[model samples]
Target: MIKPFSVIATRLVERTIRINQAARTFYACEKGSIFINFGVIVVPLIAVVGLGVDVGRGYVVKARLSQALDASALAAAPYADNVVKLQAEFTKYFDANFPSSFMGVDITLAPPVISDNGTKVTVSASAILDTTLMSVLGEDTMSVSASSEVTRLITPLDVVVSIDTTGSMGSSDGSGTRLSSAKDAADILVNKLFGNETESDNLQVGLVPWSAAVNVAERGVSYDSGLNTFVDGHWYTNNSPVPFITEPDSDWQGCAYARYTDNSNDDDADHLLYDADVGGTIWEAWEPMPRRVVNPSNGNLYTVRCPEWGISKLSGTKSHATDAIEELSNPTGTTTIAQGLVWAWRTLMPGEPYNQASIKSNLRRAIVIMTDGLNTSSYRDAYKGDLNVSEMNDRLSAVAAQIKATGVDIYVVEYHVETNLMKSVASATTAPYYFKADSAAELEKAFEKIGTELSELRLSK
Candidate 1:
């Protein structure tokens, strides 16, 4: 009994000592637990925030750099005549748009790569951004890069000017007549085109002066009519075969009247081949009756021919065009703008009689049609049936549509006229192409603007 009691007491004492040691271990283990929690959780949280800030800063750098690079590429495209010039332009533009350094940030730009055709340019810019919080992670800075590409705007321009030269063009405004003002403006336009370069393979110009009628059938220009017989100078009159002419030509003039659809369907929307034709001896052909000699006793008419309409064929030289204008005689007869438009369209078309220079692929053709008066269908008019002003406008509109359909840009300028009718004429084409000149000086300015507008810049990429 005594031995069992002593053993129990010793075991109880050991149990108490073991319980005290466990309590002391619990207090010691929890002593610095708050600091451990802070080190483990708060440190990583701060690092993550710092990384986020640094990464956000990298995005900012890239966005700004990208904007600058894009601007630089675009500004440099036009001046990219050579690598040195393009690089200089890019640097100038980039420096102006974005900072080379921001708060110790350094930027580097690569020499832009210009495509073989010089139409496209690609550039890349990079920047090194110093970090704030991320430095704690042994990363002192971050890198960002931006790239951009740009394309040039204009294609080569082949332009034609079909101007009215009726007696009405000689009618005066406050200063000069319409014809005179047009001549001055055209001369200035030519100067702008050729500049100092006497020779350019890219630009070609044609001039058509129309009055009373155009000299297509009578003048016998090569046309799609499949009628090459005009070279023989034997032409029908008033729908009669040449043999039907009993009297000699009293006044045989080479003036193209409207063809079947051209005259009957004056507002021809299809703008088929008929609209381009000047017609033949068939009722479709619109030519003035052959001149007849008055037997004096019988008062018979004779076929006395007048000179054909004058056209300056397509040429690349300013001198050629200006000289042709100089050769033009004083205006006479009625206004037939449609004929002038058709002939001008023909001048730009590739193939025989014209385009001795050969039609280059991808040629950009354009037309500038100027008229001082409205179209008519009197004896002065070329159509078989008389057409009122509205009908005349419809015909003009149809012809304009046809020309544009051929991928030829058309610009219409009405001189001293402010009618929507004229504005409608201008509206048939792209915007900024329609011009209403109230004065001679304004006319000149319009021509200048046309020249500038034709040589414009557009964003390609």
Candidate 2:
């Protein structure tokens, strides 16, 4: 019994010592773990938050770069002609729009050359931005670029200044009488075409005075009815033959071919034909042609008659048809739009004496056919019985088609076309044609908008 009790007591003491050692080890381990947890978790959380702040700053800078690039592109478009000016403008724009705080922003423009020759304008620009947070990820900076090539807006413009010269033109619109306002608009266009006396050479202007009938400039000719005998009324000469105005036929004996002629040796043959009709009492056949020279003294009018053919034709002179515009005050007769359209086509035709150069080739060719009233039957007595609106529309549409086929753009404007019969007629033509204005102000705004769209500078050398 004594041996057993001694053994028991010794075991109890060993257990107590072992328990105390374990308690001390637990306390030491808890202290060490607290330090390690603070370093590994809390420190990394702070570093991650710092990186997020830097990343956010980088994004903000990148967004600014994008906006600045767009603003700079727009500022550069207008100055595309002057490279130095474009660069200067870009710098100004970039500075104003993209002021960077983190790092300096740089912009570059390529091919700063602008040609005056009719061509397209194109511009390329790039921007570089520096980042703070991303740099910590081994990325020090970021770059962005943008490019925009705006083909200078070329508006197809055709305007028939059908001034309401009727005595009412004496009334005022904005500044003065309707006539005065019309003149102001015309002068604006004139100034635009010719900056000074020298630049005027590149542009052509023709006047149409309409009262009973729209009479064109002395140089203007109408290609509507009588000429339709040639090519079934299609004025674009390439079509099949219908009629030639200066033919020895009985219809044109009283008139002469006043169109322009090159100094071709063969023009003398054309003169022979004209002379036979004017001077000769009989018709003659076409033969091998000889070239003729234009009389410089006659403002470049070619009047050489058939010397060999013994035909004494009258000299070529400007048309006697006065401008019908002066009589706008006495708009007594009915409106025949066919006549107006024909005249418009002639005014834009090339190779014609009145049309000095091709308005189509050099400048944009556009026609604005506007009318308050519908087709009439009074003036053209020949078609009195055949009062077909459909027929009239077909004629107008045919002419429009021919003109458009030749690359001339057309726009038809109507004051009250919705309830009118001619609305469908204008609608069937090539491009956009419509009208829905209730007030005069709307009308004027529409006109101005059309003008702006059509007058956009078409870049050409």
Candidate 3:
């Protein structure tokens, strides 16, 4: 067994060589496995990072799409009546808001949906974003969508249109008579407010066709304990005798003079020209007296020939307003803006000679006064027929302030007349409350714009 040492040593060397070769082979295999594992991890890591980036891009695209959709819906809301026009408006606004190929995204807009009897508008859109590194997972693109809706509802509104039927309106404004033009403009406004309904529970309109005086018609008269007479819900006494009157109180016509304490003394007078209350102050019947001019044809010197068209109280019936407007003919008398405006204010109030209005806090009241001339008459000169321009303007301003304080918006439309008085009365410093029209066409456009604004469009979604 202990034979030759050389043979044993050779065998041991051979064994050692084999062991070293095996170790080398194992090392090479371990290095190859590490490379394979690194390669396998790199693809999934890249996919995860790309997923975050692409998802973030999709979110951005979705936000932009939602905003554009909202804007488009609102823009198209007003044109809900016509499908073609509504779609045109929606596309116009959406394109303006969101550009094509924005954020490397492909956008597709769906057609607008109009419902609820043309009161609701709905818009939707979809976007696709191409994937960059996520293509390894077979997802070449990401999808996002957005939608928006808008609804327009009309609010409760009460409007009184005070048209100037003075003699100056009988003249021409390069088209037709100013009075005719006013009628046409007023008709347009009424049509807009009424829309398809002949009568509405939330809408009421009144007409006050005024000139030098208003024809209040015949109203009941009662006597108080102090011999004071309550005529047409206004208190009056013998002390303030009907101005320059020779006829008895029973024969009194429909016209009434402005309220004042005394008709004789202008210095010691307390003017109630702007008061709308029924029980407090004294009033006087409007009697032209001996100043009446005789008609050459009839040989009759009518004592009181006020405006033929009288005041029409607030009513929801469209025909009532249109009928009153149609009767706006044969305009004759000087301009008395204060009288027209005060009467309009009274019509809007809940308690007055005209009690057609309700006392709701949410009601929106407005006065549209269209005039073609300046103030030529005043309460102080109602009997004398004197031209008190300054006093008339002051009274108009005071009445306008009082009306505005009661949350009633006053819109002044001066047709064929240029004056700062109307602008000031309308408080035009902040809004487009005052409009000046030199022609009949311009006047119609102005009234149309006002009517559209008064219609009150809003987003309800």
Candidate 4:
């Protein structure tokens, strides 16, 4: 214990060196542990950030794919019956919505799936997105997929087709008489609407062959005093006899003039003429005048003839409508578009003379008025042929407004001529509701389009 000073000093120095070596070894161990911990934490953190970015990109691609799939499904749903057409439509809409190099991702679209006897359509697509950050985790790419479904459901629908049977329709429209072309076009529409079935539970169609006046009598459309209603007579004048005609009420044909109380008051006159209320004004029976009226256009004397074919009330049987349309021959009368439109509107009403329409709240009513000329005649009363062209057209427009207000879509198909009134009436329903067909083929195509639209294509999923 009692060693020399040099020995004590050497021991102290050795002890100090040993303590410094221990401290250095401890510091090196801590530094090595920190470096190992940083390596472990940073690698995972980078991977997690990359996963987030890649997953976010995957979600974006999936959203876009969903949108494109939906569009494709809806576009192809209408053509479910034809495999060729459905495929064509699906590819067209998908290409329009999603490009080949969308978001730098590779895309593949599957064929459209049609089921439920062609009533349902399903569209699916997928995208292969190359992963940037996720590659470190052994995921080189991510697959995102989406699908959409559409269903073709036929809703309760009532359609009234009012065709002009004016004399001008007898003229040739290149291939055949305008009347013949119109008949062919109408047949196409009915065929499309009915499809393979002769009758449908949810579909009802009515035909209104109109000229200077409607022939309601031929259909036995008359007012019923016992029921206090006009049975089968849509909006017919209530308990009114023929005016200005010396013939007895029994001799009155089923033809009726437009109702009017006071022509001097424009508002009141229009209200009386266009309003469907049965109690407002009385409709007078049209009787052939003893003297023929002078034809202004040809300076020849001609008697007015009611359209031979009467209004065909809404019926589920396709043959009933076709039969009425087939009888649309001998076009020989002045144009009275207002009368035709009003009669068609009455056919769609649930409570009127033709109460064939359903009282359901979801019923869809539409009026397709196909005319070849302008209004050349007025109501069959005092101003029968006295009103000028402007007055007649104004009346037609007023009636159109009233019809559209009742939530009935009005489609105007102008054949061979276009008019401002036709455009305005069609626009009242919506765009593309107005179709101008210059030829027979165009007319057929227009009706086909309308029938397809009315079939009611919707997305079920």
- Judged by lDDT, which candidate is best? 4
Among all windows of 10 consecutive residues in model 4, the one with the lowest summed lDDT is 239-248
Question: Which pairs of residues clash in candidate 4, taking residues 3 or more apart in a chain or in different chains?
Answer: 217-254, 237-283
**What tens-digit string does per-residue lDDT give for candidate 2 at 1-461?**
11222232343355445545654654567564766644544433443444455445444555665566566655554544346766787678767876644357455545544446422444455555454443333444445454444444533233433332233335455544455444444444333332222322233444443322333223223223333332332222211121233333222111222222223212222312233342323223221111233444454533222111111111111111112222233233344455455445555555432334344444556554555446544322212222465655555555555566666555455543443444443434323354444334545544444443444543232
**RMSD to truth, every model:** 16.8, 20.5, 16.1, 14.8
Better structure of 2 and 3 per lDDT: 3
Residue-level error in angstroms, candidate 3, position 364: 2.6
Write model 1 residue lDDT over 1-461, tens digit each, in one string.
11221232343355446545654655466566766644654544555566666666666777788888878876665544557767898999999989765656688888898676555678997777676775565656666777888764435667888888877777776576677788888876776555444655777777877864565431223222223234233344432222211222334444444552433444333323323332432332234433333435456543332224456777877677777666555666666677678767767776532443336676778888888877755532555335676776767777776677778887888887655665555535434688888888888878866765665534444
Off by over 4 Å in 4: 1-47, 81-83, 104-106, 114-119, 152-155, 167-198, 217-308, 318-332, 377-386, 427-430, 437-456
Instruction: Report model 2's TM-score to 2 decimal places.
Output: 0.43
Residue 421 lDDT in candidate 2: 45
lDDT of each: 0.62, 0.40, 0.69, 0.71
- The sequence of per-residue lDDT tens digits that candidate 3 reaches over residues 1-461 is 22122332343355446545654655566554766655655665566666556666666788888989888887676556557867898999998999985887777889987774555677898877777666775667767888898865667899999999988999976667989999999998887677556777888999988887665531123312255455654544343322322232543334556543332322112223333333563343333322354545657654544676667888999998988898789988888887788778877777545678866668999999999998885322333344467866777787787788778898889998878888877856323478888888999878877776777766555
Worst window of 10 by summed lDDT in candidate 2: 309-318
Distance from true location, Cα of 388 in model 3, Å: 1.6
Against the true structure, candidate 4 has what lDDT?
0.71
Give me the runs in candidate 1 sitting further than 4 Å from their true place. 1-154, 216-254, 260-309, 352-358, 427-431, 457-461
TM-score of 4: 0.69
TM-score quality measure for candidate 3:
0.67
Candidates 1 and 2 compared by lDDT, better number: 1
Best-fitting candidate, scored by TM-score: 4
